[model samples]
Target chain A: MTNKLLYLSQADVKSVGLTMAEIIEATEKGFMEMGNNRVEMPPKPGIHPGEGGDNFIHAMPAFIPAMDAAGVKWVSGYPGNQQKGLPYINGLLILNDPETGLPLSVMDCSWITAMRTAAASAVSAKYLARPESSTIGILACGVQGHTNLEAMNVLFPLKKVMAYDPSPENAEKLARFGKETLGLEVTIVSDPKDAVTGCDIVVTSGPILKVPHATIQAGWLNEGTFVSCVDFDSFFSREALKEAAKWTTDNLDQYNHYKDKVGFFVDCPGVYAELGELVTGKKKGRENATEKNFAANLGLAMEDMAVAPLIYKKAAEKNIGTWLTL
Target chain B: MTNKLLYLSQADVKSVGLTMAEIIEATEKGFMEMGNNRVEMPPKPGIHPGEGGDNFIHAMPAFIPAMDAAGVKWVSGYPGNQQKGLPYINGLLILNDPETGLPLSVMDCSWITAMRTAAASAVSAKYLARPESSTIGILACGVQGHTNLEAMNVLFPLKKVMAYDPSPENAEKLARFGKETLGLEVTIVSDPKDAVTGCDIVVTSGPILKVPHATIQAGWLNEGTFVSCVDFDSFFSREALKEAAKWTTDNLDQYNHYKDKVGFFVDCPGVYAELGELVTGKKKGRENATEKNFAANLGLAMEDMAVAPLIYKKAAEKNIGTWLTL
Candidate 1:
């Protein structure tokens, strides 16, 4: 009968001390649920603001019955915010009690979004990437670059990281984190092709754009490399996508939804399978070591649902957040 | 660059003291914006929980550029909650700074939803109903019934109310409010037809159902009667809906979206115009005195966006809410 719900700030969410491995495991479980047809997720409904119509606020809602998680994540991504010294993405996540449909917790979505997105890519790479993959090429060395590096390091025996960013300062910052915090050899590549040609796994984490200014060329990627595109075709050219032996996505319905409306995937290679299908063994993953693999993992609300409840429980146990009454 | 947002509970929202007249005016402005193509409102995306799939949580987001309003209302409706001594609908509205896309306030959505929904109905009737409207009939004697009565009282003169509910206690409650608060002649009608037969304005506030158990039949409505359906075709039969000379809705796209997916309004009359068109004078309302006009106002997020910012400003000026840092 209590109407109090826990509220966690961005700092409080980080204080919960969730590991990259834990987030990857949770995100994989969500995809497994999806593969088994146990979750409900509608393609995100969004509104574009500003004159250029590039900034967006999306309402993503999902329900995973097996996880007992049901809620909505109201998040915004304003590429213009970076010029104002604000984060590019910010929002909140509301987790509801499955039985009564009452909000149980409200938490900052930035931290969860940052970690879960990289975790999804990590989950995809685990099934698609070569087992002996030791080098990673990361584009756009922002929050996603750092988190994706951390996540990939958890699954692969990464020996060195090649980072590329339009801003040398951002690339240097990520390089420092990779060398000091993760204890890996890091290289800052001036050309985007230098970052992609020799690496065994490549991750493109640039902003999703309505009109892509893609730089990665068709023949740039090494043979047997696995490519994870967190950004929606903004970093990879159409020819580059077609060069892959098999291209998969996190969710086929969501990819098709955005492709039709936003005009992202135009005349590109057809998706071979959803990541969930690969996770549940419903489809094959990296059948041969020499076959190039690619996955465009547009984030899903179910991934947030998968990770948020765990954070809420941990924060409650540690007494780390404020409880506000409704 | 402040990351703090005002949080108002339900009591704090009530303390702001927004009148029905103000709410009606604001809702009218929202409709005008819709008609003028100045607002961005996507069809609501929802998730149905529970085994029976009757419980729902919907994310309604809108941006009204002229009003400088942008936000999302996360609301849930569980009919089973009534038996558990909980309100059937509970939610929170988060208003964001349109310039920076940072949240400015978070407030309870129940009060705003109730008031704005009725205000929309009243606005519809203002254009569609006879100018000398006196008697009003309300179908469900719940929160919407009382609010609808209050809204109708603001726009009409010297009225009587015919209240109908399956439960006599609820009807009695609404009857008491009509007589004591509004000082109107009130009657509790046992038959649904009695509530609709002689009224100038009829309001149906029943629960929105996937499979509607319609009771009101064709020929039940009187000539020159204006019908407002807050619920989705749950009270009025298809024949009753077809009986209207002119049929309109709050938003045509939303109505069609739901109609295709939820199987409501199957084989019903085609809509003549949106309520926004009527508000903006693009379409006629009631051209003749003998015409029966009907409008189904499936509540819009733009309506909430219209009312919520006003409450936030008032509550801030009064220092009536908690400021929580993000």
Candidate 2:
């Protein structure tokens, strides 16, 4: 029997034209599967290859039987790469044929990581944020800052973006993209507090750190602000996290796994629900307009599994990817 | 910057013409790095996607800084595939540039898995087996049975083979290959005991089980015998395993991780040393002629990381694989 699979490059993946709404829908379906206990997702296993155990290459695998998606994302994060003029994250996603366990496609994971991660935040915000939420605070204005704005724009009628980064150049780049591509009023902020203070939604998008040098203070966040932490407590202080009335994460097992190793969720509020539970209506999301809502959506493998099949199917239909024998 | 990587199919990987000795050397070097605490290899994490949770797709990642190799082997084992006229194992090995943490190449892992696993057994035998060992007993005469004979032939002056399999046809196939390819006297044993008894070297290559139905008993092995178990404890009974003078495995953390989950090493002899310790001269292997040494080399990701860089380098030099933009 011949073993052949499609290869989708970053350009090819982008050419597939998967909208943020579509990715959010797929991501929500994946969370529903997780909520219903129909998905098999192991806590991501990673290896730190760089000095000081800061840079990591993680293997994230998940099987969503409901979507017939089974695969792994081999992704790496090198904080030093920013100085080396390379992307901080780089890797590939391998999608498999669930029946015979053969690879069906190998695609660039950078785009998927950017989109699905933002979509996960959007999904969390869908349940946790008010429908009329307009302003968004974006910390660490890099790839995720741009993608998060695009995704949040798809969900809420956003009017302005408050962006901050250690590098003013990065914040400016995101502001340019926000103004040109997203057509939103973008304000480059000087401080993290300025970003978080009166925003309807806040997204922390910095690099995930083992020991966070947190800067977001407890009272900086406005009441009823929906906070989506993609950076794993890197920007949010323990006191800041405690201000949330409802605390939820994408996956509790994964959060606890990293929490044990990295000491991230220590002395925080007890987790009110997993994002999936809210998706499945098994637990409440935002109860009152005055209550603070926080969701730490650590990017899950099932989110990639959910969106990857769509990319593969559409790419195959469009004949946009290269096919090679295995 | 262009992100391009060579894609080597099974044919391309085979065309590299890597010898069993070369593979063994690479695998041994990987073990030496592990012994010196220079390699980063997390315990392989897997997900069972099939019915009854019997079938598994595992993500094995390792970083061998000494070899400048960092990558992952995304592999799957579906026993049901054999009945459907497909190979029981299939997947890909992704090699990465250690400095930048970007993928360098993608290659078929089936050949690597088969060859590297057998090379691990041969590396174990290099330390544990007597140099004058001639006869080898092989249980489960499938692909591993063929590869194990090839690897052992590279190390020892082997003259005869005793092969056993549940399927008579598989045993016959291996027997024919042994006679035709290696010019060794082949015997098809009717029972597993017949295969193990009186053999200087024994290799058990079967399916790894969560709950093993072991068959090999305590008295079957001979004095001065070297045993390599690639199939976990599926073939060797607890009493049989206890017969070994010293017990060793590829990695203790991995062994204990699986042991906690699958109950494989429970009540067995304590592992005296990892195979790397023996390779690095930190631990003795076969101390005397009458000693029985056993190594349960549950295949390490560093083995693939060590070998894959060689394949990628050679494939690039030979221009043998397709280069795809990522």
lDDT of 1 at B104: 82
Q: Indicate the residue-level lDDT of A276 in model 2.
A: 91
Candidate 1 docking: what grade? medium
Off by over 4 Å in 2: A164-168, A187-198, A207-220, A236-242, A265-267, B166-168, B189-194, B207-220, B236-242, B257-260, B265-267
Task: Highest TM-score: give the candidate number.
Answer: 1
First chain TM-score, candidate 2: 0.95
Count the clashes in each prediction. Answer: 0, 0
Cα error, residue A67 of model 2, in Å, equals: 1.4
Task: Tell me how candidate 2 scores on lDDT.
Answer: 0.90
Per-prediction TM-score, please? 0.94, 0.93
In angstroms, the error of model 2 at A203 is: 2.8
lDDT of candidates 1 onward, in order: 0.90, 0.90
